[model samples]
Target: MSDRELRPLRSIRITGDGRCLFRSVAYGACLRRGKHPPSDSAQKELADELRAKVADEFVKRRGDTEWFLEGNFENYVRQMRKPHAWGGEPELFMCSHVLRMPITVYMYTSSSDGPRIIAEYGQEYGKDDPVRVLYDGYGHYDALQPSVVRTQSRL
Candidate 1:
């Protein structure tokens, strides 16, 4: 694709302090609200807050979530409430429910393919302007934003 046809995408790097997933979602939430990404301190605060809410959400919907959880549901929720606990696919799904918005996860593929959508959550909340995030295969997530490109006027 030509430069003019290609849309520039920017990824906001999230801290990998076991809270990357929450930070990424928080950053994307800000972007979705048409606001600038928060400062690092603010991102951390938001992430922790979101993490707490997600843990609570799991409890609130335990009947539906318990079966899919790998371990004892009570213990799982207890551990997930810890700030250092890493979040994975199940938490991502709970995040969607807690935020009441859809989330779209993209991953980088071969250079030729660029980035592609690997998973999506919260479709029941509607599909418009889902919070976008990039997942590095190893276990990190970053917020994605569509950059605005300005064209120069040719003489």
Candidate 2:
């Protein structure tokens, strides 16, 4: 659908207090499961949990590729667990793979027709369900839920 047709039904804004990306992903995961996102403290806790889980999974599954990592796996995991780590494409991909959840990111900027899908990870396991994350050009992320319109009624 076009951007206009895909306006958000609701949005959960994530604070840019150094961990917006992690929080965004955490919130998106909840949305994917058809559940409400957690509060700030809870979201932070969830993000921390996700970070640790993803880090362990990465080492277990991709430890051989440690050379590609900027630092040792231990340090990588340590940084990831920090609240100021600032998750990025690598983290997003890892999270998607580890969690088996499809993630779709929409970026809104001055040079775009509208909010456009900037990144996606993971294969849809059922019903092609995907979690969505929105990135504002100014440096913040939010969970975006598309509005669903019912056009017909049962007779």
The numbered model that scores best in lDDT is 1
lDDT of 1 at 3: 24
Model 2, residue 64: distance off in Å is: 6.0
- Model 2 residue runs over 4 Å out of place are 1-10, 64-68, 124-127, 137-139, 148-155
Instruction: Estimate the overall C-alpha local distance difference test score of candidate 1.
Output: 0.88
**lDDT by residue (tens digit), candidate 1, 9-37:** 67888889999999999999888888988
Error of 2 at 55 (Å): 1.5
* lDDT digits (tens) for residues 1-155 of candidate 2: 54466565456688777677777888877877878768999888887788877777667777554666676777876787777777777777778876788888888667865578888887564325577788775667787777677678779
**RMSD to truth, every model:** 3.2, 3.0
lDDT of each: 0.88, 0.74
Q: List the residue pairs that clash in candidate 2.
A: none
Error of 1 at 86 (Å): 0.6
